[model samples]
Target chain A: MTVDVGICSTDHVNAEVYAALLSELPDANLVGISGESRERVRKQANSVGAAAMSHQELMDAADGVVICSTNAAHKALVDLALRNDVAFLCEKPLATSLATAREIRDRCAESDVVAGMAMPIRYSRPMRRLKEQYEAGAVGELIAVSGVNRGRMPGGWFVDPEQAGGGAVADHTDHIVDIVRWITGEEIEEVYAETTTRFYDIPVEDVNLLSMTLSNGASFIMDGSWSTPQKNSFWGDADVELVGTEETLAADCFGYRYDHVSDTGHGRHTESIYWGADPNNALLRDFVAAIRGESTLAAAATVDDAVRTAAVIEAAYESVERGEPVDVDR
Target chain B: MRQIVAVGPETAVRAHVERYDRFDDAAIAGLVGVSEACADGIGAPRYESVSDALRETDADGVDVCGPGAVHGDALREALDAGVPARCDPPFALDGDAFDGLVSLASDGEGWLTAYSPHRFSRLYDRLRTDVDAGAIGSIGVARIKRTAPFDGAGWNSSYAGISAAADPVDALCAVLAHDADVLEWTFGAVERVFARARSGGRYDHVHAMFAFREGGRATIETTWSDEWTPEPRVDVEYSGNQGRLHFDEHDTLTALRNGGDHGQVAPPGDDCRGGALRAFLERIEGEERPPSAVDPEGPSRAVVAVRRSVAEGRPVTLTEEGSR
Candidate 1:
């Protein structure tokens, strides 16, 4: 049977990406799209060759719902998905705050619904290879890990604190945090962070750096900055470096590039050349497989994983406020 | 020409001598080590002790490169002989020892200097120049990482044991002192420090967080693990209000400006030890002053602060009273 999937909030950046990927899944069908604006949702739905339905209607009709709404809308949409007994893939962060993320996680655990967070970096081929080598002791016992996720300041609701939850720390931290946990199989135990809003006039921060200690005696540093300028040739960078007892490994999550310099209006551009499978399609395939009971959730970000990331991020924010390292509530 | 008595037959000492020999103005008059066999490895005249080398040779200065514990005694001997002295980091065991050396150097006519080869690297120099030039604006955060292959022989020393005459943590701190000096040079005086350290078998690791007096922050992570390749890995990054600057062991300097302007600068030459030795000789000639290239006092205090933070299980403030 086809796994019917509906996307909420067509305005989200990943909504169309998910819609396109889901439509390509052999056993998955994009049933409908819903958002706060009917006209916008209808336009996105028509463009993706799906039906535009109300949020309640979409929840009732789909086997799995993809929550692509703004940060503030995740709790309600997740609640609706849980109420309808549907498997859901919520965007990263799981929720706006630690309490809300935990509530969603706990509620999902208590139910039979399959839930995952949309963490595409974990599914990327380079990151997958790095994780495999690290787990196989190719780099020896893990000693430390560092990551950089520098991207252009995402405008729109992302800059609004109420809609996005926090700034660069909230928007960019969870992905790398989840990746570190997934690679090392360790949870973050404490965090010391510093944040600043230096680049933009927005209320939220654009630069954040977090120093974290893992449960397994490994230290981590993450640079989550929206400092990429508009004039850059590429979107930004997502890279990770892992140091171990015998060797060191570094993976550029988006480093496979093919530069194109044309005299047309677009000028120079550096296109990221993904070698094999598309990460989004891989995530969708796994989600479909999990919903069909064909396989258990493995590499995909699970509910607990989402909550752990939220906890680290929450502790990071607290560290920023306290001006010291704060213990993470696991 | 300035004739120098080189102390120790360690690889670091030999490397420094080899680099310094490239310069025509400095000459190694003798090689001193605890054992004559060790000193005989070098081409220069072999001596069993620093005093023997200084007493028998017309040396103008001494380069102390023995184990960290001997640094204080070597410097005292050099200062007593009234010769300029240069040593690597972890120059003294504690602040009091460092202060005593500082007083000796002040009273004597010979200059006292410490070698921090990383600071002399062309890439590191460029980073300092860029930051001072306001290329990246005011620094908000700085991070430095150093990882090297573990040498089991170093762990055999009682100093490396958990219960030694001195704190075993100092063994790791000695390696990290240069990094701490770089942090101080790039940012400013660290006002506070919190750190965590672990040791296993022949390896040790330390992760420290520093809050600077000028409102910036820094994290320094150093490790001597068996897993790293033969070539050591070093990385320094400075994130500022207007941009970011990064330098790595690959001799690459990457600058990311706020408006999306990215530039990679690679300076020529990898002769960091040569640069440091040249600086030392320059200081000996009265062309420079004490604390040239690397300040022994700053890194000494940083090590103490890190050790205290680890021992007290709290951040150590760097104020006048708290540091004491």
Candidate 2:
């Protein structure tokens, strides 16, 4: 069956991904796009031959919806999707709060629509290998995991905590949490976090360090910060390291093409292992495959996952207030 | 367990003592002699006459932080004493000083010297790593900005006083060498640099810009008097078609794609200084030399870049003649 995809909002990374998706998939017709203005929506949906329409009208015309709106507007967008019996792809940190996320998840669950989360990194080859290695005992027993997902501060709505939920934690927690769960074969049972703002003066904490205890006794640390000095230039890389009893495997997620670098540091030196595929394209292909029902949803981060991450975010603010650890309920 | 001996004035010794874990200063009389101490008033290391202390001590290296005038002499003496030596930057005051020391270091074991700590920062190393990993695609543009508030304390004593009294031209030349070496480390040899430097009567508040030969440019602005210290804010702004990369001192990386919010990037740890120092020390232990000073004619090339750029309001092409 031909799929009718309605892209909601053109102000996010997922909007570009979804727009690019329409270009890649000829079978997928982008019937319309909804935004604050007809002009804005028309501009974004122009290349896909889609028209600009009111939110309700666009929802009514589509078989599926892509909710790439700002985080605060996610619940309302999902509500629109549900009213029209449209399955939706909710760009993540799914809703600003767990209650909102659960509300959407429950509503989508009761509908005939298939729902998915925009967590493309999970479908990347390196993460797939990392998951495989964990199961094969390559990273034996998963002693610990660490991630530094930092970037320069960007413009607009992102700087507002009310709109984006949080800073580095809001933007970064998904990929790290997604990969950690995939690698450990367990869930983050508890999390203790601390957040600080040292570099930029954004209202939300730009630097946050989260320590999580997994259900399998493995502990992990995630340091997410937009602490790069504002020097009129480019952004940096996101890195992940999974340390086990026998060996350590690292993924230079942005820089090195999501390649794995292994080190025993005994007699042998580090070796770069290629995962083979541009991760961006890989993620898109996986999303398309899922949309076509050719594959089961390939373990993208759910609203549940984002809510859990937001729980860590909530605990981080608490820790910042109390100057001590606060337990994070998953 | 290793001990370090610093034989210079309190000011000279403080910087070294603060940086190295183990450091001690030898007596002025013990190093140069009684009379030489009377001349400089203990403000400088007895670069020419500090042989006795060098022969007596078993320290790994001696950082000759003496005045510029006597640095060549003190360095010559230290080299003869065979303790393996490094001195406070510039190698010495002029081409002659650097040449003499280069000759001595060429023949000696455990001979390495680095004048500035900024070059050894983790931020730079991480930038180098990203460049190596092809993070921002081809690295079309690489910009490094180092600016600071102007002040008198460090200016009168540390920077201006030393550079001016020695050889104003050579001092700027030496500082340029450090900048050139940094650029060379990331982008290959600087084929050309059209540069300009202005010292606003106040020695500390100097500004300079260098347009590199192959592609891109760099600007270094420093003032010892500004209220806010931008000392901790060295950033390498690299722009590529695919993505733009920012490597700043705070250990944060950021990338912007198709005009959305920047995707956050991970960075190396804060231990890049200690890491570089440890690497330098280990390289010495392994009997390898530190990366050669930018080039033999590096200072002269830098001098040409600054001279021509300052001379002509417009850009100047750095000729192959001055290059190392």
Judging by TM-score against the true structure, name the best candidate: 1
Candidate 2 residue lDDT tens string, A141-170: 565565666566664777788888777677
Q: For all candidates, state DockQ relative to the true structure.
A: 0.18, 0.02
Writing each residue's lDDT as its tens digit, candidate 1 over B21-117 gives: 6778888898865355555666678876778888999998888753334456667788877788877665665557766776777777665666466
C-alpha root-mean-square deviation, each candidate: 6.3, 19.7
How does model 1 fare in lDDT?
Answer: 0.74
Quote the B-chain TM-score, candidate 2.
0.61
* Candidate 2 lDDT, B164-210, residue by residue in tens: 22433444444444545566666665554433333322232223444
Score candidate 2 by TM-score against the native.
0.50
* Interface RMSD list for the candidates: 3.3, 21.3
TM-scores for all candidates: the values are 0.82, 0.50
The residue-by-residue lDDT of candidate 1 on A167-188, one tens digit each, is 8998999888888888888899
Model 2 chain B poorest ten-residue lDDT run: B149-158
True contacts kept of 2: 0.00
Query: What is the Cα-based lDDT of residue A307 in candidate 2?
Result: 68
Please report, as a residue range, the 10-residue window in candidate 1 chain B with the lowest summed lDDT: B154-163
Q: Over all chains combined, what TM-score does candidate 1 have?
A: 0.82
